[model samples]
Structure formats: structure tokens, C-alpha cells
Target: MHIQLLGGFRLDCGPGPVHVVPGARRLLALLALRDSPVPRRVAAALLWPDTTERRAGACLRSSLWRLVKPETPLIVVTEDALVLGAEVDVDFRRACAFAAAPGASPEAVTMLKADLLPGWWQPWVEAERDWWHQARLRALEVLSDRFRVSGDRHHAYQAALAAVQTDPLRESAHRTLVELHLADGNPAQAVRQYQSYRTRLRAELGLEPSSHIHELVRPLLR
Candidate 1:
């Protein structure tokens, strides 16, 4: 089973196009919380907290059934819990884990292609989306550290470049690019990034770049 959490939620199974439904995304988020088995009642509360218990239970049941197909079991319900079926793989979780680990792997970097569920707007969606953002950034930092240690200047440049693309506003992204360029003996590129950051900060916030940043790039001015 293929599960998508990058935009609203979508689940795909064998021999059929992906299914889209309301509430399925919530169910997927509950299941994505690692090995923790979400209690039936808790899932009900999160998805329909303001509703009556009876109504919430009914909604959960309906959402679960929507994934049913003769050929695939997308979800499994036990005596009192719910989980993504054994056949299903949760990519966000995998991506988060890989990104957090010590070494950089292709799979880990690929996992952070976009922010989590760019299309969803529910409160719960925001919570998970924030989580993935912070997690992905942390992974990029780890990759940068690994590359710097190994003297992999090219990969280091590439990783920092990708990180900034993911979060252009993050001062750390600009900072990382600056450091990577300096280490790669490209101080001119570092100065260019600094100037870009200066313009962005002035335009967006009407403030100057931090003194620390100004200090770092001072020697590189050509």
C-alpha cells in the first residue's frame, strides 16, 4: 500500500487508482505515530473532539470502511486499537527517522521533498506539518555535518543548497550555504549568499542582517 501525507491524504492499493476521502488523512496521522497503538476512543476525540461519542465512533468506523476493497486491507482494527495494515508503509515516518539518523542517505534526503500535507488546513494537520518541517531541517543539519567531516565539499554544497530550497527564509539555511561555500574555497559565492540574505531581510522585515552574519561574511567581501 502507498500512503501519501504530503497533500491532503491519499491511499493506493493494487490494481486501482488512489482513493480520496475526507477523514482518511486524520486516520493516517494517528497511525503514523510510530508503534504506538492509538486507542479507539482517542482517535475518535482527535478527529471529532467536539462531537458526541456516538457520532465520533460512527465517523471513525465510516472512515475506516472507506478504505475497504476485496483485494486490499488498508487498515486493521483490533479489539480496541487501529493501525495501518501490515502491507502499508508510512513514508513520512520513514523519512523522519532516516533524516534524524547520523549519516546521510539518498533515501533520507529524498524523503524531505516537500512540507508535509501542503494542502491540508485542519488544526491537527498543522501540528503534524510543523513536526515534519522541524524534523526535515534537523536531518539536513545532520547531513551537512557528515559531509563537512568527510571533506565531501561537492555533496556538502549540494546538501546545503537543497536545504535552503526547502526553507529559504530560515537564516540557518543561508548560514549553512555561507559556511559550505567558504569551506569549499568559494568565498565569492558565500558573499553573494550573504548579500541575497541582506536584501531579503531588509525587504521582508525592514531589518538588517544579524551582526553575527555580517561579521562572518566581512572577510569574504571582494
Candidate 2:
């Protein structure tokens, strides 16, 4: 069984996609992300923060009931702990692993493109979402550097561009992208990118690009 949390939440078994109700979906999402046995009380409390302990436990029980399927058991509930079935594979974990690997592949890059559960506003999800955003950006920058060092300018540019697009306010991303443009004999493009970043950074944060970023494009600009 595959549980996808990046981009969105989906569960697929051998047959096909399995339908999960909204309330249960949140519970399943948390379980898939945690990837370990959580105490029943803790799980209940996290999922239903506004409710009393008794009410939260009841809600957890209800959601667990809704998740039960005769054909496939999606969860493993112990006397005091809850976890997703051992057979389940979470895409977020897989993508994170791929990002840290030594070499890049088409599949890894594709997987890295997806954000973790975009538009999910739960407190439980926010930290994980931020974690993914930072992880992906770092991975993109690393791959860009590696590709650039290997004389693969096109892929290097693509990776650097992706990093900048992922976080427009990240000066390091813009610097890397500008370096790639200059390396590829596109000084005008490098200057344009630097100017674009300068404009946006000024408008958004009322700040200028750092000295390091300026230095990267200074030679080309002159």
C-alpha cells in the first residue's frame, strides 16, 4: 500500500485508490507522517485540540471506526498506541530520502517538486510543511551545485531556477541561479535575475540583496 502526503493525501492498494473521508483523512495523514506508534491519548489530543480529553478520545474512536475496512486494514491499534500498518509506504519519507542521496535522478527530482500537503492549516501539519519546504530547497541547491561542477549546465540551471522559484526571497537561491546564468554565458540573464530579485526583495522586505549576492553579479554587470 502507498500513502502519499506530498502535494496531497492519497492511499492506494493493489486494487486501486481507497476512498477516505475528510475527518478520517486527517487522522490517517498524521499517522502516516509520524511513522511510529503514538500513544492513544497523544494522538487523540493532537487531532482534536479544541476538545476535552474525553471528547477527543471519542472522536478518535469514531474516526478509527470509519477507517476500518474488511478487505484492508489500514491501521494497527495496540492497547495504548496507534500506528499505520507496517506495509504502508509514505511518499514524503521516500522523497526526503531521495533528496539526501549522493546522485540525482529524474524520479527523485520529480518527487522533490511536490510540496507537503499544500493548504493544510492544522498546527500539527505546519512544522512538517516547513520542514519539507526547507529540505527541498536545500536539495535543489545541492543538486544544482553538483550538476554545475559536473559540466551539466542545463540541468544545473534547471535546478537553480527551481530553488529560486521555490523560495523567491531566499538570496542564496538567487545567487546560485545568477552564478549558473553567468556560467552558461548568459550575463544579461544573470543581471536580469539579480535585478528581479533586488526589486522583489526591496518591495517585500524593504531590504537589498546581500553583499555576497551582489558580488556574484558585479563582474558580469560591469
Candidate 3:
């Protein structure tokens, strides 16, 4: 069984995709992401914080029951804890591992392109989503640098633009894009990019671009 948590939550069993309720999906996602046996009480409380303890526990049990079947068990439920089945493969883990490395292959970059469970507003999902978002941003930046060093100017530019689009306020991403333009023998474009970043930063945060950014474009200005 393979589970896709990036972009959206999907469970693919051998025959086809498994259809599950939203609560069951959340439960499965939480268990898969935790990647370890979570205490029953803790899982219940986190999954249903607004409910009474008894109600939360009941909800957890019901979700677990719906997720399990004699032929295809998605979760391992013990008296004290719950965990994803051993056979499940999660794509997010693979992307995270690849992102931690300095350079990434095109395939790895594609895998990192997805946002984690976009539009899911669960409180527990927020931290994990933020973690993947930052990881992917860093991966894109690293990939851009690697492409630049390898003389793949077009790909480098695309990667840099991707990083900028992902987080406009990230000065490092803007710097990468600026450097890409400079490397391509387009000082005019570099200056334009820097000016755009400066304008956006001032309008959004009432702040100037950092000295590092100014220094990067200083030589071109002269």
C-alpha cells in the first residue's frame, strides 16, 4: 500500500484507491505522519480537541474501526496505541529525505513541488505542513544553485522563480533569482528583479530590502 500525503491524501491499495470518510482520512494521515505508535488518548485528544475526552475516544475508535478490514488493514490498533500498518509507504517521507540533501534530481524536485494536504485546516496539520513547505523552499533554492553551477541556466531560472513564487518575502529566494539574472548576462533584468522585490517588501512590511540584498545588486548598479 502507498499513501500520498503531498498535494492531497490518497490511499492506493492493490486493486484501486480506497474510499474513506474525512474523519478516517484524517486519522490515517495523522498516524502515517506521526510514523510511530501514538498513544490512544493523545491521538484522540489531538484529533478532536473540542470534544469531551469520552466523545473524542469514541470518535477515534469509530474511525479506527472504519479504517480496518480483514483483508486490508490500514492501521494497527492496540489497547493502548494506534499506528499505520507496516506495509504503507508515504511519499512525503521520501521527498523530505531527498530535500535534506544538497542537490536534487529532476524527479526529486517534482516530488518536492507539492504542498502538503492543501486546504486542510486541522490544527495538527499546520505544523507538519509548515515543515514541508520550508523544506521544499530550501530544496528549490539548493536545486537552483546546483543548476546554476552546472550551467543549466534555464532550469536554474525556473527553480529560482519557483522559490520566489512560493515565498515572495524570502530574501534568499529573491537573491537567487537576482543572481540567476546576473549570471545570464542580464544586469538590467537583475536590477529590475531587485527593484520589484524592494517594492513588494516595502508595501507589505513597511521595510526596506536587507543589506545583503542591496550588496548583491550594488556592483550592477555601478
Indicate whether candidate 2 or candidate 3 has the larger lDDT: 3
Position 174, candidate 1: lDDT: 81
Residue-level lDDT for 124 in candidate 2: 87
lDDT of 1 by residue, 1-222 (tens): 777665335666765547556677578766864467778988888888889999999999898877555455666779798877677777776776676673655555566656677776667677877787777777777787787788776666666676877777677768878887777688888899999988888898888877777777986673
Q: What is the C-alpha lDDT of each candidate?
A: 0.73, 0.84, 0.85
lDDT string, candidate 3, 1-222, tens digits = 888898898988886788888778988889888867999999999889999999999998888777746355678888899888887889988888878984646777677777888888988899998888898898998898898888888878777787788788999989988887887789899999999999999999999998888998998788
lDDT of 1: 0.73
Candidate 2, run of 10 with poorest lDDT = 101-110
The better candidate by TM-score, 1 or 2, is 2
After superposition on all CA atoms, what RMSD does each candidate show versus the true structure?
A: 2.7, 1.8, 2.1
TM-score, each model?
A: 0.83, 0.92, 0.89
What ranges in model 1 sit over 4 Å off?
Answer: 15-17, 70-72
The TM-score of predicted model 3 comes to 0.89
> Positional deviation of 166 in candidate 3, in angstroms?
1.9
Model 3 regions more than 4 Å off: 68-72, 218-222
Highest TM-score against the true fold, candidate: 2
